[model samples]
Target: MPHSGPSASGDVTGAGKLDRDVLKVAAVVVLGSIMAILDTTVVNVALQELTVRFQTSFATIQWVSTGYMLALAAVIPVTGWASDRFGTKRLYLVALSVFLLGSVLAGLSWNIETLIGFRVLQGLGGGMLMPAGMTLLTRAAGPQRVGQVMALLGVPMLLGPIGGPILGGWLVDTVSWRWIFFINVPIGLVALVATTVFLPQDEPERADRFDFPGMLMLSPGLALLLYGVANVPGAGGVSRPEVWLPAGLGAVLVAGFVLRATRIPNPLIDLGLFRDRTFSVAVLAMAFFSVSFFGVMLLFPSYFLLVRGESALSAGLLMAPQGIGAMLTMPVAGKLADRIGPGRVILPGIVAIAAGLALFAGVGAGTAYWQLLAALFVVGLGVGAAMMPIMVAALRTLRHREVARASTATNIIQQMSGAIGSAVMSIILAGVLAAKFGVPTSQGQLAAGAALADPATHDAAAAAAADSFGTAFTWGLVFMVVSAVPAALLLRKAPLRDELVPDVVDVPVGKTVV
Candidate 1:
C-alpha cells in the first residue's frame, strides 16, 4: 500500500468527501467494531436464562457478563503498545479472528464455567477493536475529517448497547441461548474478508521499548480489582475476605503502576496525556458518564425482565425507545461538535439524561408503561447527543503521533469504569432486594419469572422489584449529574482541526504507510 508523498494524502478535506481508500478502511473497522461492542450487552438479558440452563446460582451466572467485561478492561492497556509494534491493520485482523474463534468455543460450551471462560477469551480480542480502529481512522481521515469519521466509528458504540440485547433476546427466545455466540460467525467472517481485501496495510514503526513492567502490573491489577467488585454481590460485604483481599492488593499494585508511569519515558497507558486540559476534562467526564451510563443501562433490561417479569425478547423490545431516541441525534451531534465545541453540546445532553433518570428514580410497580417509555426516549436523545461529543472533545485536540496512545488510554478508562459501574449497581440492587425488601434476587428471580407468567403473584413481586430498582437508579442518577462538571469545561467553539495534520502523499493502490 504505497501512498505518494506529493498528494499529501493526509489532507482529504479538499475533496469534501472520504477517499475510496479511507472509505474502505472505515467500512472494515465499523464491521469489526459492531461485533466487539454488541457482545458487551448481548448477554445481559440472557443472564437469567443461563442461570436456569446451567442449574447455577444467579451470582455465578452473572459472571458471564462480568468476566467478559473484566477481561476487556484488563487487555485494553496493551493494545496501544501492540499497534505501534505490529501495525493496527494486522492486529485488527487478528483480533477479529480471535474473537470469532472464542465465539465458536463459547457456543459449544456445555457448562457455565466453560462459557464464562470462553467469554473471557472473546473479550481478549474484543477489547482491542476500538482503540486500534481509532488509531487507524484518526490517521486515515486526518484532523480535518476526524470528527466526522470518529462519529461514524461511533455507530457501533451507540447502537451496540441498544441492539445487542434485542438480537440476543430474539436468539435466546426463538432459537437457543447458544445461538447468541454462533451468530457472530457470519458477521465475523464477512468482517475478516472485507478487512483483508480493502483495508490498506501498515508497517511497524520504530516504537519505544515495550512497557513490560507496566503491562505486568496494570493488566493483572485491573483483573483482580474487577474480580473483587464483581463478587461483592455474592460476598455480601466489602469486609469479607473474598472481597477485600484481592481488591486491596490490586489497588496497591495499580498505585505502583501509576508511580512507575511518571518515571518511564513510555508508559503503557501514557499518563502524560493528562497534561492537556481538554483531554483530561474529557476523560473525567467519560469516567463519570461510563459508570452511570453503563450501570443504568445494565439495570434497565433487568428492570424489564426481573421487575416487570417480561420475557427476554419482551425485555429487549421494551428498551427500543432509548435506541430510537439516540438514532435521531447522534449524527447531528457529531456534525455540530465539529463546528462548535463539544462542551455546549454536552451540557444539554446531560440535562436531558438527568430528566429521564429522574423519572425512573421514582419508579414503582404501578408506574405507567407509556411514561416509562417516554423517559427512555429522552434518555436515548441525551446519550446520542452526549457520548460521541465527549469523545470528540478528547480526540479532536491530539497530535497525530498521540492518537494511538490516547485512544488506548481512553478505552481502558471507559472499560474499567464501566465494569465497576455494573458491579456496583449489582451490589446496590441486590442489597435492596434482600434487605430493604425481603426478597433475595437468586430466589426472587425464579419467583418473579413465575409471577409474570401467571399474573397472580405478579402484583406483590413486581412492586417489590420495582421499589428495589428505583432505589438503585437514584444512585445512578447522582453519578450522571456529576459528569456535568467536567462537560462544562469543554470549549464552546471547535478547535483548528486542519492545522495539526502531518504531510503525506497519495501512493498507488498497493503502496503502504509505515
Candidate 2:
C-alpha cells in the first residue's frame, strides 16, 4: 500500500516528492545508526583512561574494543537470515534493546573483564543495526529515493570518527569515562521509541531452514579475518604467526563458505546479488576506496601526535575539517547523483581523494594547520561525495526482496575492506619506520616520537617520521586512484524503475511473483 502522505512535485523524477513515511523511517534508522557508529569510534579515545582506572595492561584493556569488533563480525552474516525469519520492525527493536542493555551493563562494570564482556554484548546488537536498518530504510524509500535517503543516513557515519574522540576525551577529562557508554542510553531510548511509534510493522517472510554449515564457515572466517587484520599494527606486521595464522584459516573457511553457498538451494547469504553489473562494480569500488579512507583515518592522528607532538585533543580538533568538508558536500552529491548519475559524481570524487592524499604526502612536519586542514577537507569531500552515491547505485539496481542480502553483503565488504586497509597502512608504516630508524619494529614508534620532542635530535627525527608517513600516505593515494578503475564501470545514469525489475522465481503452476 502507498503511504498516506499526498505526493507532490519535486526535482527528482521517480521520487518527485518525499514520502512522509520514508522520512519518519529514515529518522529512526539514522538515530540508531548514529549511536552504533559513534560508539565504535568513541571508545578508542577512552582506552588509555580505562587502562589507568582499571590498573591493567594495554593488552587486557584492548579487549574492550577487540571483543566488540569480533562479536560484530560474527553476528553480521546472520542478520540477513534473522531479518527474514523474524521481521524488520521486530528485529530492529530487539537489536536496539540489546545495545541499550549492554551499554547500561558496560557503564556499571567494576572490572576490565566485565567491561569487555559487556562490549561484546553491545557489538552483538550493533552488528545487526547497520544492515538490518539499511534493509528497512532502502525498502521504504525504494530505489528512486534511495540516493536522497542514503545521504541523510550518511551524516552520522561521516561525523562519528571526528566527533568520537572529541566527545570521548571531554567526557574522560571532565566527567567519568563511564559517561562515554552511558551517553548512548538517551539516544538509544529515543530511537527505540521513535521506531515503535513511526515505523510500520513488517510481516515475517517464509523462513528457510537455517544453514548451519554455512554459518560455521562464514562467521568464524570473518571474525578470525578481522581479528588478524586488526592486530597488524600492534603485532608489528603480518610476519608474526599470530597475525597470519588466523588470517589464513579465515580465508580458507570463507572460501569454503563461498563454494558451498553457490551450490546450496538456500544459502545464508545470496551470492547471486553480484550478477548485477552496477551492484558488483559499486561494491568493488567501495571496497578499494575503504582501504584508502580507513588507512588515512588511522594515519592522520598518529601524524599529528607522534610527528608534530600535538595533544590528543589538538589532533582531534585538526581532524574536524575533513568532517566539515564531507558535511558540506554529501547532500549536494546525493541530489546530483539522483539527477544525473552516480558515475559522474563518483569519478570526480575519487580524483579529489587522490589529490588530497597527494597533498598530504608533500607536507613536512612543520606544515601549517591551514594547509593540512585544506588537504583533509578535500579528502573528506571526496569521501562524502563517493560513498553514499556508490551505495545508492548498488541498491538502485536491486529489487525490494533483494535489499536485505544486498545490505548485508555491502556492509560486510565495507567492514572487511576497512580493516584490511588499516592493517596494510600500519604494516607499511612499520616497515618504513624499521628501515629509517634501524631499530626493532616495536620500539621504532617510541624512538621516532622521542626524537621529535628532543631538540637535539629534532631534525633527524622529523625527517625520518616525515619520510615514513609520506610513504604511507602515498600508498593510500595510490589506492584511492586505483578505485576509480571500477568507478568508471558504474552505470552512466540512475537506473530507472523499469530497468530494476525483480528476477522471476520458479513457483507452482499459475502462481504469480510475490
User: In terms of lDDT, which candidate is strongest?
Assistant: 1
Off by over 4 Å in 2: 1-30, 43-77, 87-90, 101-120, 131-162, 172-179, 189-205, 210-212, 226-244, 395-404, 434-439, 449-455, 491-514
Residues 190-287, candidate 2, lDDT per residue (tens digit)?
99999999887877776557677987887678757755765565577799887899988999999999999899877766789889888888989998
Give the worst 10-residue stretch by lDDT in candidate 1.
Answer: 505-514
Write the residue-wise lDDT of candidate 1 on 76-141 in tens digits.
Answer: 766655776787788888889889999999999999889989998999888887767766765676
lDDT of 2: 0.75
List the candidates' TM-scores in order. Answer: 0.85, 0.77
Worst 10 residues of 2 by lDDT: 505-514
lDDT of 1: 0.77
Candidate with top TM-score is 1
